[model samples]
Target: MESAVEQLLHSGTIIPAHPLALDQYRRLNENRQRLLTRYYIASGVGGVAVGVHTTQFAIRRPDINLLEPVLRIAAEEIAAAGLERPFIKVAGICGPTEQALAEARLALKYGYHIGLLSLGGLTAHTEAELLAHVRAVADVIPVFGFYLQPSVGGRILSYEFWEQFVEIPGVKAIKTAPFNRYQTLDVVRAVASSSRRNNIALYTGNDDNIVADLLTTYRFHVNGEIVEKGFAGGLLGHWSVWTEKVTGLFGRIKNCILEDYKGAGALLQEGIAVTDMNAAIFDPSHAFRGSIAGIHEVLRRQGLLEGTWCLEDHEVLSPGQTAEIDRVTAAYPHLTDDIFVKEFLSQDSIKKLLLHA
Candidate 1:
């Protein structure tokens, strides 16, 4: 990794899993897509992860062919912003070795800083096969391992799998989102056991336990030494919506770490509130069938998107999911950024920002 990129990655910042913006016809809404990128930048995200799960992996299908286009759109928007500080660009890399390698190359071509390698589809492969797959892509670009929850398309990756994963020379970080406490600890302990542990960053993808993951410290005894690790930040789907509030919440969490603050009572309460909101937005009730549409609904309601239309007609919200969303928005008004987004859309300067090529 470049020194600056490595610095920002380790320093801990909010990186939202960028979503795909589409028209009612389910075509790429380039203008709305660019506008969404602008919203993330304006909302103070440290970076954006494009072509990831939140963006819908279906985009990579041969018939759809949206992976490169979406990646290029985000890259262009980031470049047009001309940020003074380093901003991490993570491109999601999926499929087998050959395809994953091709995606990595494409991501690098577009100036992405890291490849978030997803192992969800390769569940049938042996651990050794999976490791080889990881190394092939890692050799092409710095990698961020993803442990997607199985409730979606993900399969369960064992601790043994992650133990070897951390040893890959090009692996730079891990986004632990198994949504299982035991599995999350496995990633932490695996990194702790590595000689290059300090070089690797751990980020929480557990939207259900975002606050607690950020607040707790994971300590392990390795080589008769105490090795402590905590989530540097999050690379989350939940953060993709209500990002301004997410940034502020992350700032407070980071401050708590810096000060070694002991008063976590209030923060823990906030965590429950966040989990409640996530249940509504993530639709945990229906095994996350509505997760993507749930995200779109929030953006649509805020006018960042035209509507909650997904590429597949069957991918719409689950029955009563909208009512659940309504309940959370009304219940946790502080968590939503409706006012911030409204003000942002009204700004003449933002209009000019969106006009950039």
Candidate 2:
């Protein structure tokens, strides 16, 4: 296992447009192609976020560095499952500064081509320090600045904040969950107006308006904060619900959004199907674990893993909740019938689930 200082000091050169990176992008394209083959039309792009906690078991057993190896295993598993282009985000809200940085570093070193950084903890820092951190990580991996929703104690980053940070050496993307549609669009406009055109990507994490926002050039806001135009992609948070189903539909979803397809609501419904189905299985009483549990619960039902672990003491979903999860999967219609749950559910259970899946 690489020490933190060793990992930090090793200035690994990023191969410019490396075959591996291009291969990854190509693999994503292939995944889309497979989806078209499956449905005759592309759906939307689907990406999954594998939490670090899920990999703890693997790290502990192998005498490996906890975060990096886990991320590598998860990425390989996601790719093997036909989600060749899974977007991996470090479990930011709960991770410490060192852990977050190490995870991001491992993500770059391993196959997780994209990185997510927390905006909540960031906003607490001065703009200068925040930009410095963003620049530092961006140098190694393509980073998507994560702005968690306000409900999770998130904050609003100003246009100037983005203006400065976007210029950082390696920063390339922004993830904003504007509580309201207005604020959501505002983030879109801000990214569009930024100096970097195609270089910088903007992803609206506000699921409610993402479909509609993609159709228009400008992201509209209730506050009348009609910002500049921005290209949309990278639905990092949406992955928990639609991981496998998304493999074959991302292109369709992108086209639907761009073409202003009429059945947008239905599209949302289709995407929401996985989330809703999973939610029905674990919600309310299981809220103690919060949405992270929802992510694990969905993965478990999909046969990704046999069990889950709550990172924090307060976040554990009750045993009754776990039983209910099993019940939900048992009762789920065609979704669970013959689906093979993958072995690389986490670092700890990788060998087990991989053998089974």
Candidate 3:
């Protein structure tokens, strides 16, 4: 494992949403992207995951191709931020093996450190086929396996699939975001059982179980001795919203773990408020119609976003989602770090981005 990736992967990573100009649909708002990168770096997040689902990868089609531009500007923004610690810049990779590897190479060219491989485009694939796809991509650069939820068009992988995944050369990490306990454990167990177990880092992408997942100490016998394991950290869409506060919470949790503090119950309890806010935003009632909108609304409130607009008109907040956002903001006062982003917000940039607003 590369020392840089090993160092950066051992902490929480935030996935920032692509901020569009207030009224312009499908536009990549570069100024806001810079500000977001600045804020995320200031908040002490260990890394950033861009071009992922949270950034609405759906918009990066062959015609428009926002992927390269977004990654380039983000690198520029990171240089502007002058961060001391190296941030793990991640590029989300999808489609077939050839396309995915091409994207991975582009990401590396644009200063991204790892490819968060999403096997969404290759539908009706077998485990062997998927394994081949990942190995081919990994041949070019380091890779992270993603078990995205079905709700978001993510194909669920079996433990058998994960076991094979962990053994793949250059498969450096796994983001377990199945949104199901059994599936989450399947990935964890796969890592635990792999011959290259020590070489692979496990990160939780299970937003609903973020805190508990971090607190858990998974014990298993990897060799003659009993080997213990746990998630090194998280890479979450949920973290994009309340970022600074979320970063602080992550620090506190990690501190407790280091000190072996006995307040596991209280630590897990803190997740409920965040989960409540997630429920409102990720509203299961509407199948998350407002999920992205709800995220934008939070950022808009913080001045990280220009407005709650999306690429597709129907991508706007679900009905009553604005009210739900309001309710969570009121109910979870401590959960927000709006002032953090607001403190450094550029009204001049906002005005330039949205002339009529």
The lDDT leader among the candidates is 1
**Residues 223-304, model 3: lDDT tens digits:** 6777777888887778777788987788778888888867777888888887888877777679767777788788877666
Worst 10 residues of 3 by lDDT: 14-23
Question: Candidate 2 regions off by >4 Å?
Answer: 1-65, 75-103, 122-124, 207-231, 257-262, 268-289, 318-357
TM-score of every prediction relative to native: 0.97, 0.61, 0.92
Cα error, residue 146 of model 1, in Å, equals 0.9
Q: Which candidate leads in TM-score?
A: 1
The C-alpha lDDT values of all candidates are: 0.90, 0.45, 0.77
Task: State the weakest 10-residue window (summed lDDT) of model 1.
Answer: 348-357
Assess the local accuracy of residue 178 in candidate 2 as a C-alpha lDDT between 0 and 100: 57
TM-score of 2: 0.61
Winner on TM-score between 1 and 3 is 1
lDDT score at residue 343, model 2, on the 0-100 scale: 22
Ranking by TM-score: 1, 3, 2
The C-alpha RMSD of each candidate to the native structure, in angstroms, is: 1.6, 10.8, 2.5
What's the number of clashes in each of the models? Answer: 0, 20, 0
